[model samples]
Target chain A: MPPTEDPDAISKTPPEPPAPLAFDRPAFHQQAAPEFACALCGAGLTGQYYQANGAPVCSDCRWKAEHESGPPQAGRVGRFGKAALYGLGAAAAGTLVYFLVLWGTGYEIGLIAILVGWMVGKAVFSGSGGVGGRAYQLLAMGLTYVSICASYAPMVVQGLREAQAAETTAGAGAPEGADAAQGSSSVTRSGSTESFVRMAPNGEPDSQPLTQEEMQAALPLPDDPEQMQPGQTYKVDLASSEEELSPALSLVVFTVVVAVIALAAPFLGGLENIFGLFIIAFGLFEAWKHAARPAILFEGPFSAGAAEATRAPALPEAAEAHGE
Target chain B: MASSADVRSPAPGASHCPACGCESPAARLLCPRCGALLHRRRLEELAAQATQAEAADRWGEAAGLWREALALLPPGSQQHQDVGRRAAEAARKAPASLLDQPPGGAGKMPKILGSLGAVGVALWKLKFVAVFLLTKAKFLLLGLSKGGTLLTMLLSFGVYWAAFGWWFAAGLVISIYIHEMGHVAALRRLGVKASAPMFVPGLGAVIRLREAPADSLEDAEVGLAGPIWGLGAAAACWAVFLATGSGAWGAIAKLGAWINLFNLLPFWQLDGARGFRALDRQQRWLAAAFVVCAFVLSGEGMLLLIAAVGAWNAWRSDATTPNWRILATYLGLIAALSWLAVRVVPMPT
Candidate 1:
């Protein structure tokens, strides 16, 4: 009889080594069956069951346990569209809050606007609850820009109106003092939120000395001695030809520059919003990172003897062939 | 097989034990005889007997004795590995008749090839990940370090200008560059090895320290240097504003002061936290008060973030022992910055 027929010798032979384990770790084995639920998903494992981490696991969960990276994400388009809408809502809300702050404080708080961008990112990511791609990031940024423009519109419109009014009043030959005083007063009074600082003619811009005739014409001295002291020094505005000649060129340049700036404000803003958008993207990336589920683990249930049977070559057949 | 001699302990009157030659009394569970653990001594004796058997070419006896020695030693320890290796060697070299196996085996090539194939497949599967890691390492280890500091600064300036506008971006880049240079200068003065400033595109500049600070005080000095230099640059900007009477220069000066002050906020990875290492508990409280007041007066949302981060750090930094002299210097600097801020935006000229 073959050595296999001898039960004693068969029992004495060592079990085949466990199959080379994945992740370069030692093999796992199950000693006995469990009378409880699946360790991975808490499902009631009935009849034949797989062992995972020394506990019973259902076949479905067993597959997931073997594949540790979790399942591929589902529904890319739907999630991103929802995220975009949420970002839009956040942007609108942020801008409204920014404008309110600007109104209350009489100063544009840019850092607060950046906070809005961050919040918009957080809101959008949470609303979607999925990994976002580049397109989704772009969409968030686009909405941020919309918010920035919307907030700045009221301020920009006010600045434009004041600039136009100042130009017309200057055209109407308002005294240099009146024009300078009025422009400065309007800027300070309106509380324009544009951070665009313009180089307007501050104070009196190095005026030429006035003639006695021009001084008399400029300010009519009060006849009463009580109202005006005889020794009081008086300064007058002079319409110098040289000053007028230079102003035409300077005014043209100034107007052109201001107009160019007014036109390019939105473009420059869009550029800055790129950085803001990048910030929002970073926040969204962080939010999206947490959406992945942890991987489950599975252990095999085969006895040591059974495991040996699976791994060993067909020994009886090979031995018979060798005997032949 | 343990004989009577091997099992027996030395007599109490014996001056010294034979095994380790330690003088001790006999008839103890532990080694009053040799100062060796009784159980451990037996294992060691067994190992010695195994070595003798192996020298005498008694393979089976050596293998069995080595196995006993292995069981007594900690798993994965040097002794365990040595004993296990000797046992395996004895088993392999045992006579074919005793081992019940054919000698001079030659059929292992297929198994060896199978292992090689498995390794190849693993490498193939991990190719993408390997390439990705290699690329990242290349950028970090080689790319940034290759260029001169000035070139890197220029590149950083270009990036900043592209991101922020020319008017705002230039001043900001110069300000940040100056700040990082301050760190480099402080590091040099303290005889610490450090690299020149390297600027990140959207973020600011940083100087890589080749060596760590000698102590918290040294660290505070290195940290304090950045803001001091920055404050100087800002003061210079204020001077330009004074000379030119340009509102743009005034704005830049104000921004410089505000940024330097903000960097003084005590928080992780900020200049403030490192500088805060120099402060005692009272000074920390004073610094906190100052930051709070500055935030309230500034209405800057960035300051709010800094304060939040700073407060969190302060809560967590209980382990740091403070240096009072550094605190006084830091406070003096803060006072100077405050004065500069007032001068920079002195009521509307």
Candidate 2:
């Protein structure tokens, strides 16, 4: 029932307002009946209230009322469209996940935030991967990537220097295999590959592509001398850089450039610590680059880890060949 | 309790328009006794003229020359009006003029921003309850900052009754009118014919230029004319407070600085809004970062939150201005100034 003009309608208030009327009531009701039509937009409305000062203002006008500036003019609705929307949603979801992860696992969500932003930016504005479209994605990715990396520069420099100092001290008291492996690797040329070999408990080649059975064979019986627990490392070996570590000093310049750009944006919202700064910085730079040429900023997706496993080199076979 | 519209619009140049003629401090601009260029000099023309004058010894001729320019016209003249609008416009464009004024243009964008933001704030505020009178008043007052009659804060407190109650409303009138006056002064200083304050609902206040400035440099100053004009008003307030020992004037001074600073925040829907379109991308990014940091520190998370939403909308934010660079300098100056003031003059005592 339309709201009766009677103030007595307060006494006659229905159990509850009719379910929220769609913004356009005329179209909805006119599909079958008569109802209040929006004075401006012609959209229909329910629970239309016609005051003495004016005609019935519907939910549509009401919504417009709620927002005074109104949406952007018909043509320039907003600065962003799909990309901004995607990034905003992604950021929101990513932030939510970080909050949840912090709640569950006490680990920082900073790293994940980096990936979230990258994805959001990439989603709306295609990364360099797209054959077409202005190179906006690449530029944005580059700026953001540089910015994120910059956030950790000061700490990384400090950490790396500390690590090098410890390595020098530890080298004096080295385990036998470490130095020899290092020496061999150093002896290799630019394209030369180095490999490490592992001996089976029984001194076998141990190259049967370790299924659970072969994996179990490498382990001793539970009651025997050598059994490892589930998911535990089995003879792990860490790799050293075939080349000397890329000079940490040089990266500082690139990092600073990113830091400056990140700090420059008007919306430099920081997240959990590292990722937030990086994301905000990246977003700002990306926005900046796009504002400029836009074509130079695009970059395609390039995560080596994301590649299929089959496509990756066969590590075990190579290790075994070295052993033979 | 009387309807303010009842106050006559002052006899056209007989005594003068409200701002220049009336004893009421609320008036900011007045009708020219005879100055009529009606054709405001676009900001671009002013810039072109200012450029032409630069090689000459213009600086040496500043005061006398400016006074001569001002004599060509007259002092000029809103609210729910905002605080910073007048001061920022004045500080930025102290020598507001038409011949010397740049085309500080954005089409209808700023108005849209103001209207949308105001409406959003109102809706959110009234989300708790919706009654006819409540919602009607909400709609009516939502974007009334540019509504003129609502602005009257800068008026003498004794005239609060005349202001129709509510400082935001009164201040809107006083701040906007005074701000426009700053523009009139600047334009006159450049010998550019300019209009008195022109009121626009929701967008606050503006001074129309009736003619262009004599040169390019004048135009640049004219582009900055509005801000300088408003700043001059603030300086006047500051000086009065110091000399007269008026605590109320002190309050106005504090508000003036802060409001101007806020307007120049280099964000959406503010004076910086103009800067957004004009600055480069790198500048904008840096400015964005500064703004976010400032908001977080100032506890304006809601703005950030809204910006997050805006970011989403502007994900395609094709902002191609050196906004960040301009913002960096302006905000840095404002922040430094604010800090110095706080240290030297405790805020509202």
Candidate 3:
């Protein structure tokens, strides 16, 4: 006589399909269950019982059921598809916002990138009925990386455009009768913001040099400027201001740092960048292990947990019986 | 009739109700601690009662009913947070008449305290929670996340670089990271679960042990491992200095060695205290004497105080016996490192 079926005792009993492998206890006890009692624990209910698994369950049991039991098994593939779609949508929106911020402020908001990753992970993992696997993790990582790259794309384009513009301007303004490449003086400014302008051998000013007071006021100097050299000319150009130089400089630096971290991590040895590369590797591993799992974020009944626990223990026994 | 019966007979298996912190789980549907219903049926009943109470301008009663409803539902579920917000709102909008009204039996002191308590709890739950919770989140990132920890350290390194030059900042952070990794390595060897090193911005990097070490000896070994590796890193920096004769590298080496030696000072939450705890009374006294002498030699007041406090803690602690051989070896190594660090490293004036 098997535990599941007592053939000798009940010849006329109505046949029923086997209980689900994941949640078997409810199906097994439903026949002998007391009406108006908790479905999972069989505790007598004082007030109305919560509806679960087509039966009434006590509040404690209901909470368990909602929390621990996986969502409905039906339409899982459909839910996964929907989750992927939602993740892609979130990634796209996040990337758009990231790029907008970068363009407007000329600063990379790393926090936004992290938020995008978290949001995409949440959206996809939750959308798939909270089912997590390697496939989901890969999808999430891919989406997140793509979104980050999308945000960086505009800055890259802008940087190249600026560089080209600067080159063209330098070429167009170069003096003739001398080698334009060599004769072209690249005026490098120091911390003082004073550019060392190269005059031609004949000594001709390209434009009128501003007075000392005008030079002091125009360039936004710190308090207590030094007395100017009486004979030296001071030039101030509105178009070639420090403020104009900042965006291009920041964009370049940001791009280079990000590129170095991304491209050079694996190759860098010793203490140089091993920690950074290690961090990335560990993150990816954790993302696969944790972020890939569909988190049961929205609270559910506790009965779900009890039911799931029972099913988990029953699995080995079920497997043994099946093998026998 | 059912409610009366529920009061007479408690439910089994629950044994304790989580919501009201009640030991006796009286009635499957109701919690005895707060007399709040635990069932879904009570949701509507509480809501209806709250609505009626609100209609009568009994805001306090209305808030209580709403709070009960909120607790019954799973937290963060759409309905739960909504009810929580409504309950808080109702509690806030209590009429001036009700706010001033004294309890039936309690004196003015009790009433004042009660009002103060209610206001405090509400303020704590609302505004203070949002910011304080982020602080907890910061710890969570530092403690649990490897990537977050690394990033945080890097960010802090960047900040340090702004104040000090890049060379010094980079050297220090790397040395600290190596020290933290030494602890991590020790933990791994002992088969304890631990996280990678996490760095607080202004403070230093720390490795969080997920599980406690097996015994005092294990703890001490883990503690000593950090400074040991740190000494090695400092030595490497010193070697670089010797080769290149760069003042910056020499300074880095001196700073690294000094920091590691400082970490050896036994104080609350310091590695030295952990290692000291494993030593016997005699050894502990010896360690203290050595520290005092070192402080006297170095003329560092902070070090002397930290050593005194750590020694006292060690003397008082009744920890498990440590492996004598390992302890002796640790002592020798530490003494050598401390002596060499102070005596050897050249500090460019």
Who is ahead in TM-score, 2 or 3? Answer: 3
lDDT, candidate 2, B202-310, per-residue tens: 2345555565343323443444444544555566666877898765566665555544544553343344444444444554555555555655555433234323433
Candidate 1 local Cα displacement, residue A63, angstroms? 6.3
Candidate 1 regions with alpha-carbon error over 4 angstroms: A1-118, A130-139, A157-265, A268-324, B1-148, B156-174, B185-196, B200-203, B207-222, B233-255, B265-269, B273-285, B292-330, B344-349
| lDDT of all predictions | 0.54, 0.38, 0.56
Candidate 1 per-residue lDDT, tens place, B53-98, comes to 9889988677667666555543433344445566666654555331
Question: Is candidate 1 or 3 superior in lDDT?
Answer: 3
* Superposed model 2: Cα runs more than 4 Å off: A1-324, B1-174, B184-194, B199-203, B208-224, B239-245, B265-270, B292-329, B336-349
- Candidates 1 and 3 compared: the better one by TM-score is 1
**Of 1 and 2, the candidate ranking higher by DockQ:** 1
Candidate 3 on B1-349: residue-level lDDT in tens? Answer: 0100101122234433334333322233433223223454567778778778878988767776776665555342335535655565565566433212232423234354457797855654454446544443443344335776678778868866765668778888877877786676565444456777778644567677765443466568789888887887788788888898777777777777767776776765678877876787767776677667766676544345546665786678665454576557555655655554554445454
| Chain A vs. native, model 2, TM-score | 0.23
Residue B22 shift from truth in candidate 2, angstroms: 55
Question: Tens digits of per-residue lDDT for model 2 on A9-59?
Answer: 677776652122111001111122212344545554333222111223344
Candidate 2, fnat value?
Answer: 0.00
lDDT tens digits, residues A24-89, model 3? 111121122223355568775553344432344567764564445544557767877887898899
Native-referenced Cα lDDT, model 2 = 0.38
**Taking the candidates in order, what DockQ does each have?**
0.02, 0.01, 0.01
**TM-score for chain B considered on its own, for each of the candidates:** 0.52, 0.39, 0.55
- Which scores greater on DockQ, model 1 or model 3? 1
